[model samples]
Target: MLAEVQADELVSVDDLIPDQAAEFVSQLSTVEPLPPDDDEMIEDETSENLVEDDSDRSRPVRENGSIYFGECRLLNWTTTAKGGMKADLAILDCPADAVHPFKGLLCGKQNGQRLRVWFGELADTDVPMQVNYQGEALLLRWSDDSVNGMNTQVMLDDGPDGVKGTHPFTGLPIGRVEGHRMKMAVWAINDDESVIDPRKVKRKVPFYQKPETTQAHLLSRRPRFISYVKRHERRLTRGQEIRADITIAPDEYIAEALYAILGITSRSELGDENAVGREARRRWSSLVGEYFDDFYGRR
Candidate 1:
C-alpha cells in the first residue's frame, strides 16, 4: 500500500520512504556527482556523519538537462460520490511527443501521499476556432477540476444555453461563433486578458516509458468516457464515440504529458508490435521499483 500524506506535505519519511531507498537516491546523487556541499563543515565531515538533506538540490540538475518520462499512479485513491462512477476507473493516455524538465516529486494531501513530477515548457499552437470542437471559439478557464497536470477535460454538454464555450462542469457564459474554427485566447483569469499562460511556460522533463498494464488502463478509460458520452449526448448513440485527441503545442508537450499522466514513456511511435508495448511495461516496472526504493529509503 502507498503511504498517505499527512497535513499538506509529503508522507512522513517513516511511512513513505525507507532508509534503504533514501540511501539509494543519495548514492545516485553521489554517482551522478550532484551538487557539491556548500557548507564548509559538512564538506569536511566524514561520510559516516554526513546527513542528507534531500532538498531541492535536484532542481538545478533538472535545468542542467535531464529528461523525465513515466506515469504515476494515484494509489489508494478515493473520489467524491459524484465521481464515484469513475471509481474503479483508470485512464492511461498521452498526448503527442513533448519534452519536460524534471521537477522533484510532489507529495500532497489531496494528491495522495506521493506524486512523481517533472517540469518543461509546453509547445505553442494556435488552435484556430475552425479546428476546435464544434464551430465556435470558447475561452476556457482552467479550473482545478477541469485540468489535471497534463490532462484537461472540457464537458461539451455542460455550458450556457447558447455560448459555444459554455461548459457543463460550471455554468458560465461563453462567447459563441458559427464558423468551423474560431480564435480564442487563454487568459490568467476568466476576465483578465493579460496574464501569461502556463502552457507558454517552458521547462524540460525526464522521459519515462509506458507500461503494458497501461494499455489495459487505456481500454478502461476509453470505455468509461464512451459510456458517459453515449448516455449524456444522445447524438453519440449512432455508433459514433465522442472523439477527443490529446495535443500539445510542441511535440515535446506530448511526451511530458504522457510522463505526467502515465509516469511512463510510450512506444506508440515505435510500432504496433506487442514488444513495443511490452518494453513500455518494462520501463514502468523499473520506475515503480525506483519509486518504492526511494520511498522506503527515505523512511
Candidate 2:
C-alpha cells in the first residue's frame, strides 16, 4: 500500500496522524504508467535531427572491378625501391607476350602521351585524372578519392643526359603512362574488367597439386576473422598491452578494423587471389602472429 502514496499524500505528511496513516495509505490507489504510443509521436525540442541514417557518407564511392592502368619509366632500379612501391600503384612491365597484372588491369583503355597516370580504381574518368611532372614536382588535376590530396616526387634531377629517370625496378626507360597513386591495386584482368585467377588455370600447375583436408581457401570468412580477433584480444590481455583509449574493439568494430587495416572496401577482396588480396591476408596473419608471439616472447 506504500506504493499507492501520491505526491499529494506525501505533502500531507505534516498533517497526517500516526494512528490513521496505515488506513489512509491502504485506502489510496496507485496508477500505472501508460505505454508509449509511438516513437514518432514524441516531440523533440532539439534543432538537430538525431534519428537519421547516414551510412552512405562513410563508404567510398567506386565502380566495382573497374580499374585504370598506366606504365612508368624505369628511371632507377633498386630492389629496395621495388619493395617500397609494393603497397602503391606503379606501371609495371608486361610485354605483349606476357600477362602483367599492372598492364592487364588497364584493359587496353586509352593510350597517348600521358607521362604519368594519377589514377586509382575508377579514379573519376568523367574528369580525366591529369598529372603534371615538372623537374621539381608532380601535380594532379580533378583527382578522385583514390589519390591523396597532396603528393610530391622530388628524388630525381635531370642529369647531363636530360632528365634521366631510373626505373623503380630495372632502372631502365619504360612508358607512355605512369601510375602515381599507391592506393590503387591492379588485379590480373582480361579484355573485360573481369578478374582472372591465374591459379585456376589447369594447363600449368595442376589445381589439386596438394589440397588441405577441409580446404579454407578464404581467410576472410567471418568466423575466421572473429577467431583471429578474439585471439588477438587474449594476446593483448596477456601482454598487458590493451589500449586504454578504447580505439580498438572486437565484434562491433571488427569489420571496420579489418577493412581499414586491409585497405579494402569489401570482404570479398580479402578472399581474392590477386596481389592486393594476398597482401591483405599476409598482413592479417602477421598481425595475429605478432600479437601472440610478442606476448609469449616477453615472458
Q: What RMSD does each model have against the real structure?
A: 25.4, 31.0
| Model 1 agreement with the true structure over 52-151: per-residue lDDT tens digits | 2233332212111212222222212222434220101111222333222212221122311111112111122322111121211122111122233332
TM-score of every model versus the real structure: 0.17, 0.19
Worst 10 residues of 2 by lDDT: 104-113
Candidate 1, residue 216: the lDDT equals: 25
Candidate 2, residues 87-185, lDDT tens digits: the string is 122334323343322211111113111111222222343433322222211111111123332112122223331134443323233222443322222
Candidate 1: lDDT of 7? 43
lDDT values of the candidates? 0.26, 0.31
Candidate 1 matches the true fold with a TM-score of 0.17
Model 1 misplacement above 4 A: 1-151, 154-184, 188-194, 197-291, 294-299
